[model samples]
Target: MDKGIAKMAFLHLSPPSSSSSFLLNSSIDSIYPKRLFHLSSNQHNRDASLQLPSYSSNQGSRIPAQWRIGVSFFVPFLDRSSEIESLKQQLLDAIAPLDRGADATPEDQQLVDQIASKLEAKNKVKEPLKSNLLNGKWELLYTTSMSVIQSERPKILRPNGKIYQAINLDTLRAQNIETWPFFNQATANLVPLNQRRVAVKFDSFKIAGVIPIKARGSGRGQLEITYLDEELRISRGNQGNLFIVGMVDPFYRVPV
Candidate 1:
């Protein structure tokens, strides 16, 4: 079975946000798509809506050199399934205490450390990530960062709640949607710091049914893509937070 293609078949992209902006790279202008606007809501009694960016069908064909290094390692390692699942379970166990509003015990910290160690050992690519691999929606399964995990609160503590990230590779835009019974979303522009790291500059934040608030000044942070492939992604935030994500339905190709 082609698990890689099977994995891709299960991922999909979310509808682009209406008020989002793109941070395009100069080299790919010829293939870049235009931005589109549509009416949705009025802010402060004035007509307003989000400005969504459009992407072309052929954009994936224009893979840049920096991304090639990462893409070259995209093949799945089916033999490592056991190790992957074990690490994932360990990560969940490590973060469980934090989810309950208690500090992580020494044992829990050790598990987290183990997971990090395994990721670092397995990660072969030491360069910037391929944008195509990061495109589309991802469902957050676990996190080691208490802050982001705690943000889910009682909802995540309960069953049937989760977080989803919608990343638009064509425009370098990303949206993090946390659904814990209710939705809290944050939109940001992704700036590539290098082959392995990207900076996230938050633009707006909003709770379900509330008007989005513009983020003040610059609230930028970095994320290192420790592991990425068709089925899974592992990223570490600048603050040492770890995130484990899986692809969502309706996938696309990762530029080769």
Candidate 2:
């Protein structure tokens, strides 16, 4: 277990120093332990191929703005290789504190041994989650699945330097989205986000019926995509401008 702890220890100490770094430098403060138990929250009540509403930007009618999009792949959780390294660093860092006598007991060493034994034994039993590429349409930044942290929810940081609640793509469509579309009767069906687990296998995707969204007080607005699918490939252009951009493969991020 010291191996696992050691890896995590270093993972916490250092993090990638870029905007794109989402997982590598996860720290104890950000890391959430895995759990076998599942707790269902809100469920999807609608489909992903819903229609979108339209909104205009606050900028004077002449200037153009574009939407900022991001996507990341997701995989199952596992005892990270970094865990061992993290533990080692943690032990080294703790030496100084230990010298200050944080714990003075004969059982401390025994406790460490027990933790190590448990980590080693459990490491063999754990497996990583699995997912598939977005049919080569979307560029993948990075991906790693996490066990649902009981109190944790995904965070979406906006371009304005403000953070907002992150909604699973499916949930965003199901709850906030409203649209009309023609779905492939043979291929597509509205499935429960919780019930579906098959790896993504789409060869192409389309975004249609996009709604414009703006930071509440920023005096700027970009399109908020609403309905998207194989059919009715329509989306709002900047400032509710409508356009049809279709292709062989479309990049998209679907939250699992």
Candidate 3:
């Protein structure tokens, strides 16, 4: 069951290092065991896609500037790029402390989804399958797939190193790797579903980066590239898990 879900979704860009402290506080909570962060409060956040309206009250409550949700909320003249960048930072910060979502709650997942959906709405890349940006070694940042995180197992028993996925659209090949503990990996041939989606059909698995096993005929799944750019890529799995991975090595090649 763990191995089955591990193959769900994969891709992303590095999160911006600097985010508004207030924004981070509003969207995420303090970290707990297993690298889990509880969702204490998210009142300030409104859907980033919607034009957030100002609220007035007899009590005169104040909304943080980050959550104001208007032209002033972002740069002028509908420059969505800046807005997208801001939300992107927020998304990264929200998950940075969650340790690849080993223990993310449903609320935490919802927050990630809400922000990701907003970014998907303004995806800069119209056709991710053909984009050069899609070719690289992407560091797994956050995922709703617990199989990759191995949340049910103890941290010492789980792969404690960086998770990565590399692809070469030129060859129509994709590969996923875990860096430490066990360098478990898998390779797949991509069958394009459209300009923005593909079916990941596994060809082989590398146990600890060595022993190879032929993939079963059933080892295939649907993955849709929902958002993409030179620095970032967002995707969804057939199991409905969201994936965010940061580009780590643009020059990484899928081993032949």
Q: Per-prediction TM-score, please?
A: 0.56, 0.15, 0.72
Model number with the top lDDT: 3
Q: Sort all candidates by TM-score, best to worst.
A: 3, 1, 2
Report RMSD for candidate 2: 27.1
Cα RMSDs, all models: 18.2, 27.1, 12.3
lDDT ranking from best candidate downward: 3, 1, 2
lDDT of 2 by residue, 144-241 (tens): 11110001222331111110111123322111111122110001112222321111111111222131222122111122222222211122222222
Residue range with the least summed lDDT across 10 consecutive positions in model 2: 142-151
Relative to the unseen true structure, what is the C-alpha lDDT of residue 154 in candidate 1, on a scale of 0 to 100?
Answer: 53
Model 1 per-residue lDDT tens digits across residues 1-256: 1112111111111114531211101001122112111111121112112233343557646868788566545423433544555554454444444532124565665676677568566654555266466676676655544444433335434323455666776777777665544455667777888887877666776645255667544445667778765445677666555566656632432121
lDDT of 2 at 23: 13
Judged by whole-model lDDT over C-alpha atoms, candidate 2 comes out at: 0.20
